[model samples]
Target: MEKLKMHTPDLAEENYKKLAALFPNAVTETIDDDGNVIRAIDKDVLMQEINTKVVDDGQERYQFTWPDKRKAVILANQPIAKTLRFEKEKSVGKDGTPGGIDSQNIYIEGDNLDALKLLQETYLGKVKMIYIDPPYNTGNDFIYEDDFSQSVADYTNNSGQTDEVGNRLVQNSDNNGRFHTDWLNMIYPRIRLAKDLLSNYGMIFISINEIEVTNLVKACDEIFGNDCHVATFVWKNKYGPGAFTRGVASLHEYVVCYAKHYPNSIEAELSEEEQKKYCKRDNKFEKRVAI
Candidate 1:
């Protein structure tokens, strides 16, 4: 067998050279992900060299990216043969009519990948709405496990689902250089599968933190198509000032919404029970309820 060697020159070196050519001070030796001192460019310093205070328009050249982004796309497209095994013990009713599933409300707790694959046969293009609250990729907080080299069958067959101590979740730490890459790999494929489960009039809402928001939106755009992007909602969930932050007071997180078609409209009607709680009446048709 042939051995792999350092075939391609370090991309960082070329990047530093370009930055150094423009701003010499910005180029300096820095410890990389591997802890080896290497020539690298200071992004903030390099940006300072640019003359524009304004960013370019999206149609021209803006993009969201990370290392091995194409791999994420490939992972999304790969078909998984895994199936969701039934959990008889955890069902609401032993007869398997849990939550009146005959009417389409049911719960199955298992590996999301396997569950999603199983869902394809029954729920493909049949779901009306989807809301996902994935693990927020904060270093040491939590992580999604994705072994890029392993096939779906390998995942189902392997016993490495849990760590040494039996923890199912993985940790994406700050020092683990593939932080963003690992996250992108995990989320992209799941979102892609979930998108397929949506009907023509369906929509998806994803709650995410700032760290992966940009990358997530780009991945969603690629999977759901750019025209499907509906809105990015900023939710001020805090009642008061939040925990200590670097510069700005923290009070908001985000929900990114996407639709199966372009220019979709959201319609909401208040129920009679909810409408009865209205305490005030206004002159502007005093009857419109707040969604």
Candidate 2:
């Protein structure tokens, strides 16, 4: 008797092999998130196989892009071998002491991208809300430098440039030519992973300053869909005006909100003072209002 094949088929890997057989020229090698060399398909070369027009580097198109944006997307989809380790000594129990594996609260200290990937198994499409205050990329911020273009051999040889844990702690200074590009690459993959964790009714609130607000919004729109954007609230965080500068001295930051799926309507409760003025029969509902 023949033995059973108990494993499920890897559709993605099967499709990749099929495509490579069809277009051998498009088959290429690239480095994954973990610095492992992997086979990749050159999208431009694959597209040209079925296109009539010239699909080369000079083609005009509408896109929100920076250097290595494709690499960022690739890194988001790549799987990592790293796993989360349970630390009993660091955990707090319901009584608020250490050595509490039964604690509801868990703190993960490591690269966030790796943590996000690990959480996908448990939290994918289950989280209702997520709030993150990422680095503002104010030229002084130390952004994660992900080099997916390098192989593991090259990375290990240059491990001295990274931190003890192999984190490339590169500062995104204004002097750096690829300052914005580096920041985008760092945040792009993280957000891509975050989107997978959201439920259908899930919402994400991201706090960002004016420096990269526009770019961040564009990136989120691409990831979460343009129709899912709920609001962008301006928060005046400072009391007095900032110091003199060449441009305007802005006193506010922005909180951008996006939902996993667009809602039919949104409602909010009226304040006590406003409720008194409107009376019970103001317009629609009794106490709450829609905005």
Candidate 3:
């Protein structure tokens, strides 16, 4: 039987030399409150004292051994069956059926998060702009109830069919234990996935009120860096409403804009036609002074 012997080598001198070369401008002497040198110590000596040792032996070989290794077991669950299937013949429009609106490019649907996810494969990194008007997190504001554990049939039936009763709207109360937690969980994953679908020069405009502006800003900062913040547009929704006698009127909403990268790269320069439209006089001084 052969026995293994380990040998270690001292690396204090080499470490001291490396530290000295790395910190060329570092001062050696310690100064006092009066700006006087309390004590002088050699940088090389100080570094050597605290330096670690490295071992290198010609016969030494590193080997990792595992005792009582366990294998990972992943259980397969039965896939849920889908109930609804679209028939192409029934989906085709009849001869007398009125055509849909021409200028209606806007699509207003329920569960924007799910809709956005479904669009991921077809529209990833293709959207030039995205604007969302989410419900403000006020005490009485309504939130879309998304099922985390819903089956495919239930989700399809609920989304495809319209009920005469009305749309399902859930009120998010501040008093709820998981009010902020639920909101965060709902928006966090969606925002993370949305980031992947934004083009290099794409922009996202989010309309928010005073209630969750801070939280929204923080979340945006996390998704898009603090440097990517373009500007916060203040849109006046109400003009002259003085219902309260105590304070100033809160009649403005905020639209936060975040760019994919540096604003200079994404920002477009004024076109020749746009500049001509604003031209009031012939001289450069007149045009500059007009605004």
Candidate 4:
């Protein structure tokens, strides 16, 4: 019998191997910061292998980008040194006993990015669905500024930015410069990591306010691919328009949904009653519903 692996797959290394296999001519050597020789893919050679004409940065193309976008991509592929341990004292058993390990539920308490990274080891391409109500950057919501290079101790002990557990939180005020840029940087890597965890049939629903809905959609389009977008459902939280801000009264938020793979899967199955109603067959098919 073979021993099971205990850690998540190194995504960067895996990607490099795949590229090297496809284009052996692109394989090259490079020196790291530690002066160690390492295998690296030559970008120029790789581009030549895939395309007849190189689309350089100067070329005009449709894209959604912000400052540090490359850094966000790097962050998603970077490996972490963190590990998760079961805390009996903090966990509740299935039978409502303390320190019992009978429960199948797991509640992780840590930085969201780190927690997501740890979950990749066991949950990659396994999760059926994911729903998240992340902080909407409305000038008051707390957003994590992920930076693994710095230690918790290195962060300033400002109560406003540093939470009790040393997670760096930034208040994305509308008045600040790079208001949208900051939020994009924060969410881009999270969605990238989340894509790995979702199975082919999995769907992710994100609850976001109007403040950042557009950017969120564009970000998801890049991560999950534009075709994978399922739908954006408007949720009316209030019966009527309550307080007026500026000149408008916000009455609802939005639930943006995306599928891991579209055309092959639907968000849900129709009810039995609804399914039976679609018995009307079209000339081209056996089962068809009215458009």
Candidate 5:
């Protein structure tokens, strides 16, 4: 049996049209709630009861029933994996072909989403570590146009395209309406797929500044699970001089680590050499062994 399949959900266009006809004014609106304008839903009784039967449409479809409050069919498919082929040119460095550490590592320069999807076949549940430094959707920052269909060459050559042009270091300010939505959409599926790529002992590290730290934690909690949380480390990235005017001088960043499974041991004892280096004085008897 095939282990993975690509899923493409179809929208019920015909059914939606029929439903729209029943309630011509089934439009979303905002109403005054106290002093604030809040979104309000208005629907017709007849439109709510209307149901459509599946016709002989060549498109793929699946039936999903909504909650008891309302009955609706959601057309969706099971996600599958497709094989991808590519040619790689062998490189000869100064010391001949780079081997050992460098040769084993694969550098795939393309859309990470598709790259990760293709990697699902061979690298599924095999990756030991995953570190991603994604874009910060602050209005001043340049947004990544995550187009899965584009080839590496097409993406690299298209200078005028938004996907290519906007993938740079810029400020993502608050004016953009889809700031949070765009960031979530870009990272959600990638993280979901990453979870499948982790081994039982594997781990993931996410580096983010204060701007998105909270959001990143929330996302990781949902993906890696609240129980798999390992630890959060604060790293001092800068030193001296620079200081924040509004608050305490910002010189550090956060690295959130999560495990794929519950660890039998929470901590590891330092090796003999590590103990000597840290303790300065050689204390052979004080050397501890792994539990």
Candidate 6:
């Protein structure tokens, strides 16, 4: 009897097929994790194709490419050895009823990547909204580890000092050679994972700043598709530092929203005060009225 293949669809595999269709020479045979022969892409050929200018128009069109991009995609798809454990004692509830401020909500404390992976079995395609305030890649903000294969002690000493609870996060400044690459690798996998969690009608919102807004949008365009991009809202960031931008004070942060599947119509929910004003018309005009 043959064994079962029960897992999420390999996006990279599908991408390989598509690439093969366009440029058959780019397809190659490779050994996978299980030592079985599998389809893979010839990266050199693919790069050649990417750099190729169109014959019809003498113009070049290429995507935002960076170091560790391929690794980031692989990381999102790779299975984690970690599992989530429930703390029954620490859980918020009445004795056994699973009660709290809201019974349906669960608060998992762990690395965000680990948490996203663990939730896949239960919450895949079930989530309606995903809002993430990722590290902004500012001078003082946290940047993720480049090589997890390195020793923890070496990483701790080199990257950053231990915080109160002892979680280490390196400060990512523009001065570092891998400043953008480090931050990109950190958030890329998480964004791909987030896209998987969204329902067909769901949406994902990302909070970003001047430092990394363009990169974040480019990543999302690849992950969620350009057609799914909704909007970007400029919000006044409350009392943030102005040292980064030099003389001109920085006041706003961007909230970028993208839909899994675009809806035909969107309706905004009204507050109590707003709802109260939607009564009868007064003199051919809708006027505010207290309920």
For this target, which candidate reaches the highest lDDT against the unseen true structure? 4
List where candidate 4 sits over 4 angstroms from the true fold. 1-9, 30-38, 42-52, 148-151, 158-160, 243-246, 265-291
Tens digit of per-residue lDDT, candidate 4, span 1-291 = 987555656778878888778999998999999999988778888777878666678899889999888988888888877788878898888899988888999888778888888899889999988999988999988788765566665654443487677678878889979899989989998998898899988889999999999999999999999999999999998875555656677889999999899855353567999879965657887653331
lDDT of 3: 0.58
**Model 1 per-residue lDDT tens digits across residues 118-160:** 6766788899899999877878655556665666556545634
Model 1 ranges with Cα > 4 A deviation? 1-63, 94-104, 148-168, 242-247, 276-291
Superposed Cα RMSD, model 5: 13.8
TM-score of 3: 0.54
Which pairs in model 3 have colliding backbones? none
Better of 3 and 6 by TM-score: 6
Poorly placed runs, candidate 6 (over 4 Å): 1-61, 94-102, 160-168, 238-246, 269-273, 278-291
Worst 10 residues of 5 by lDDT: 69-78
Taking all chains together, the TM-score of candidate 5 against the true structure is: 0.58
For model 4 the local lDDT of residue 102 reads 86
Instruction: Summarize candidate 3's per-residue lDDT along 54-169 as a digit string, tens digits.
Output: 33445565522122111100000111222223333333233433343333243434455545555555577887787777777777666655443666467546655332333444
Model 5: residues >4 Å from true position, as ranges?
Answer: 1-86, 90-102, 146-172, 241-247, 266-272, 280-291
Which scores higher on lDDT, 2 or 4?
4
**lDDT of the candidates, in the order given:** 0.71, 0.81, 0.58, 0.84, 0.60, 0.79
Judge candidate 6 at residue 18 and give its lDDT.
Answer: 73
Two-way lDDT contest, 3 vs 6, winner: 6
List pairs with backbone clashes in candidate 2: none
Question: Candidates 2 and 4: which is better by TM-score?
Answer: 4
TM for every model, in the order presented, reads: 0.63, 0.72, 0.54, 0.83, 0.58, 0.72
Question: Could you tell me the C-alpha RMSD of candidate 4 in Å?
Answer: 4.2
Displacement of the residue 6 alpha carbon in candidate 4, Å: 8.8
Write the residue-wise lDDT of candidate 5 on 1-291 in tens digits.
955446322224434565567675664556584677653335443445555443344666753211220111121112334444443454334455533233444666555665666676678789888888787554566655544457645764663444542342223467756566556555666776777789988888888778777767777787688788887778998887465446577778889888898586655667999878877644675644432
Clashing pairs counted in every model: 0, 0, 0, 0, 18, 0
Q: TM-score winner among the candidates? A: 4
The C-alpha RMSD of each candidate to the native structure, in angstroms, is: 14.1, 7.4, 19.6, 4.2, 13.8, 6.9
